[model samples]
Target: MGHDKLLVLTDQVAVSLATIWEAIKVVRKEGFEKLDPLIITQASSDCLLFEEPSSTDDIICVCKSFEFPGDKLLANIYGVLKPGGTILVYLASEPPKGQTMQSPLERKLLLSGFLDVQTSESSQSLAIVGKKPSWNIGSSFSIKKSTPVLPKVNFDDDMDLIDEDSLLTEEDLKKPQLPLGDCEVDRTRKACKNCTCGRAEEEEKVLKLGLTVDQLDNPQSACGNCGLGDAFRCSTCPYKGLPTFKLGEKVTLTGSFLAADI
Candidate 1:
């Protein structure tokens, strides 16, 4: 229940393609075209490369009581893959004990020249799979700190331009402060965006210590990610409600966290 031709090269499958007479006998005994036979071999990847392929042929790499080199097998499969064709790489993510060496294979694949290195526990198992990272040379854009229109704050706009080749540093990913006076310091300054959540805590503490609560008291607002519930949040962690101290109508922020004092 396979293909037209049968090119069984396993030592177990003794072949006799000697004379045209014997060849024809073997061919008739098998199935279809001798040219389009299924390749069955255990040769190392290096050796596999030297072999040729027929357009309508299939190469099957089998394992029988053998531990094949993963990299070698990968090379062999790739060498024969038709341009844009896929190769099903079978591997067990779980390794034997005492092997602290996590195969850098996954990370390496991410950084590799190839596209669509599908992983199960990585993505496919999660949902509709087979997505690849695309080059966005002149494509997508995110103007977080670059534009004042963006609501996010507590960021230093100093390093807004991201170098295409540079990797994200720890600091780059960290939440930063809006430049000093990046927003107008004028009392007439209105909220371009709502500073929601834990910001209230800051206001509460400031009130407790008798500090000004101008920023948090502003009425204009924006819908932060926190389900749009009745709360002002820390620009950093918006899900947690901001702490507020209501000391005789003066609100101040005392601490930072999901659940801190009022």
Candidate 2:
């Protein structure tokens, strides 16, 4: 009835487009050649290239791989989409089953700005096919917060983002992982307040060369920036079985140097 539009984000040539274009080509090949498709191809890097969009109902969003910024892409689709329009996503490629479990991709869609989205059973395809109730950009989105939300960690002091369980303790090259527990105390869901801990008095966990407990602690409380909740650990905070000092134990502990931030 009216002109339709599509946005493809996949790097693969035709394999991805086969799903949409194939369907259209099939319909066209069958003598219904009246359809005219307006296809806009883009990479995940330039998600918001189309700054001026009048409608999303007839648009499609494709990504080489569905990911974080893709969530914002979906939101963009929601903004211009007519009621009941579809948002299609293609993967860069498949990863191991253990890796793709639950499709972290859906998070990208939700993060992008789309609402009421759902993932498919195959662990690859995701869709958000609905028009958000009409509202001004200001009314629809909040200025206090950012779209495509990210995990928040508020350490009183500057801390490393290395992944827990990593054997490497290199500070600059630490792998980032989800933030875990409080070094001094257990952290609430996202308690903004700081927890207090004292230095370790007994033997400490040595990383590479078996440093004595004395080497670890230099201040009030001491701890290796170990893994989250003692489960996974970071290189900086390794699992040396360092004894946490009791009320008034011996000497030595592992913790950070007290800085203004902490």
Candidate 3:
């Protein structure tokens, strides 16, 4: 919708127009009146761009009933798109017989250098949309081929030695031991031998329990913000126990999308 002109690619313009009629009506209803969309069904029509690499702002390709190689068309569209341009693809909810692209179109777009790829399904089709990155794909990344530097270690033979001659004297041992028990009471600067109440003991206990600095007061199983556990996940978190995405991996959506796919 940010585009001044949108290019629509499809195998049959007439057929696609019929399929997306309702969507077109919705777009019109939303007060977008100046959409002079150019429809194309052939790669030869790319000559219309006059050799400009990134002239268009948005390209919407409808491949739900397309018979051509979708990958080739997508690559072509990617080449013609401007930086931060949008690419929206309409794919069939179900793959045609013998097609290997059964995975969600969103995965393919993301791996192809598009950002923020999203997918939504209608009663009859699936729509995938993505944006071209403003920066070069690998511009911010670099790998240095150099050997790692390790710290020089020095070992002392007497490191574990316990000197009995240097042990505490009777007079030194007779010094009164500080009282400790409740954390609320006895706020001593040094450790109490009895209850082990001190900053050092607390830090040691935390480290022994494998807790992070932030987790010193709150654990991971519980929300850091609201302090809620598994019984109630924070409304803001997207932590559903599903597997992470791998490009072109086959997946099946459940709930409402599943019904639409069926």
Best by lDDT: 3
Task: Quote model 3's TM-score.
Answer: 0.42
lDDT per residue, candidate 2, 112-184, as tens digits? 5545555434444434332344454554555786579689977865677777658655874867665566543
- Which regions of candidate 1 are displaced past 4 Å? 1-41, 51-73, 92-94, 98-103, 107-112, 121-262
Give the per-residue lDDT digits (tens) of candidate 1, residues 154-186.
Answer: 777785877864887778888977655323433
State the C-alpha lDDT per candidate.
Answer: 0.38, 0.46, 0.57
Per-residue CA lDDT of candidate 3, range 61-128, in tens? Answer: 66655343255556666777888888877654566668634354666677667887876666566666
Residue 212 CA error for candidate 2 (Å)?
Answer: 75
Worst-scoring 10-residue span by lDDT in model 2: 195-204
Question: Over all chains combined, what TM-score does candidate 1 have?
Answer: 0.25
Which prediction has the highest TM-score against the true structure? 3
